[model samples]
Target: MTFQDYFPIWDKLDPRQQNQITSRLVFRTVQKGAVLHSGSLDCTGLLLVKTGQLRAYILSDEGREITIYRLFDRDLCLFSAACILRSIQFEVTIEAEKETALWIIPVEAYQSVMAESAPVANYTSELMASRFSEVMWLMEQIMWKSLDKRLAAFLLEETAIEGTRQLKLTHETIANHLGSHREVMTRMLRYFQSEGMVKLSRGMVEILDAAKLEGLRDGL
Candidate 1:
């Protein structure tokens, strides 16, 4: 799909306005395993995921990568208010998990477009609010849920997206996403396997009993 096709705001603009805004947008293709943004670097534009997946993570003091979020197609990377008003550099590192397409819009040009279009301004505000709510929900989940419960939830989510019970994940990657240590995840997975709820094969994990997994989640 074209950049405009992915960003519906393009349809709301007049022909002249569309051209002006389009001129400032650039499309770039990122290869798998590429680092799109680093936590220490300053990024002045917004990166919109047009296709594929990006992992938003941070490096710990001990030099381990801890995943904070994942961005899929149609997700906006840097919220407009955070980029413009607060002038805060994005706290997470964005890395391409697969070959991905992205639309990069300069912050200055985006602000100019918002100034000229009330609809765009409102959309930007709404997007920021939604993002904030999602972050809060993630925090709540981490605080309230047990590790096993969180693992079950993550497995269900991955199954829904991948359309399979088996997940192509390593213990380290799962640990990073769950904000736990690799050794901890290894022990938990072993327990789940012993209970016949899941099966581990090489780097893949297969959910063997969905009902038992749901029970674990409900009990948490």
Candidate 2:
């Protein structure tokens, strides 16, 4: 299917606007672990995922990284096109979590369309707001919740996303996702292992009790 079929707002744009976007859109692919965009450093275009997973994260001056959101198939990402937004000042890293195929709507073309099209501008605002809301939710999770609870939630989330109880994740990788140090995460995982909540193996974690994990996440 064409990108027009994939874009949610394509039907809302006028025929000329549609043609402009269609002509400028480019199809692309990246291997797993590739960096698609690097915030203000690269000023990349808007991305619409055709398949595979993308993780959007922020890196601090000290090199700590934390995920803000993840994009899956059919998901549209606005942060990569931050150059068009103007007000965004933070640097975000967009990386491929799995080998990905996607469409890139060049900023020049999209900006030109947005300048003349109210519908596209409004749709862009809605997308920005939705992404910011996810970032805000993540901030709350980090600020208000304890690490143990967050770890529990993360395990449950990974389980659902991968459709398995065994997660092929190391403590260092999990620490990076949670924005904590590896040693701290190791302590918590050890605690979970002691409680028989998870079975820890080399570079892997197997959830043994879903209800217990749910309870931990619920702060019970």
Candidate 3:
């Protein structure tokens, strides 16, 4: 689908604004594990996913990483083009988790339209608010939630996202997502295994008891 199909507010812009934006929409395909945007200085523009998955994450100065959000098919990522907003200080790294088809709208073109069109401006504000809400939610999870609960939630989420109970992910990979050490993740998984919540083999983790996992996630 084109940008017109992805963005419902396309027709709300005037002909001039539409022409300007249409001229700058660039379609690109990226391989899995490709870093689409890196660092705070890279103004990579706005990314709209056409297919597959994209992960937006923050990397600590010490090289630890935590996923702030993930974009699946049909999701629009405002963080990638956050350079347009003067108030945003942190930059997020965006990577393709699966082979992806995407379209990028240049910041300058989008900003120009947003300047002249109320609909565009309002839509941009709505998108920013939604993304920030997720950031705040993630902050709360990290500050008050335990690793076991967070890990359980993550496994459950991964199971749903990947559509399987068998997760082909390493402890180190899980650690990176939670911003924890691999040793800690290993210990937690071992504990879960002993409790008969999961079965771990090499790089895979198979959920043995979904009920216990859900109950743990809920603090029950």
Across 110-205, the per-residue lDDT of candidate 2 in tens digits comes to 999999988888988898899989999999999999999999999999999999999999999898899999999999999999999999999999
Give me the displacement of residue 33 in model 3, in angstroms.
Answer: 0.7
Candidate-wise lDDT, in order: 0.80, 0.91, 0.90
Candidate 2 worst ten-residue window by lDDT:
81-90
The Cα RMSD of model 1 versus the native structure comes to 2.3
- Which one wins by TM-score: 1 or 3? 3
Candidates ranked by lDDT: 2, 3, 1
Off by over 4 Å in 1: 59-65, 79-82, 85-90
The TM-score, computed over Cα atoms with residue i paired to residue i, of candidate 2 is 0.97
Candidate 2 residue pairs in clash (backbone atoms < 3 Å):
none
Assess the local accuracy of residue 156 in candidate 2 as a C-alpha lDDT between 0 and 100: 98
Could you tell me the lDDT of residue 100 within candidate 3?
99
Clashes of each: 0, 0, 0
In angstroms, how far off is 107's CA in candidate 3?
A: 0.7
| Residue pair clashes in candidate 1 | none
Question: Poorest 10 consecutive residues of model 1 by lDDT?
Answer: 79-88
159 Cα displacement, candidate 3 (Å) = 0.9
Residues 1-220 of candidate 1 have per-residue lDDT tens digits of: 8778777677787787777668888888999889877653455478888989888776667777666678889888763224574655546677888899988888777778789898888888887777667767778888998899989888888888778998998998899887889999999999999999999988999999988988898883
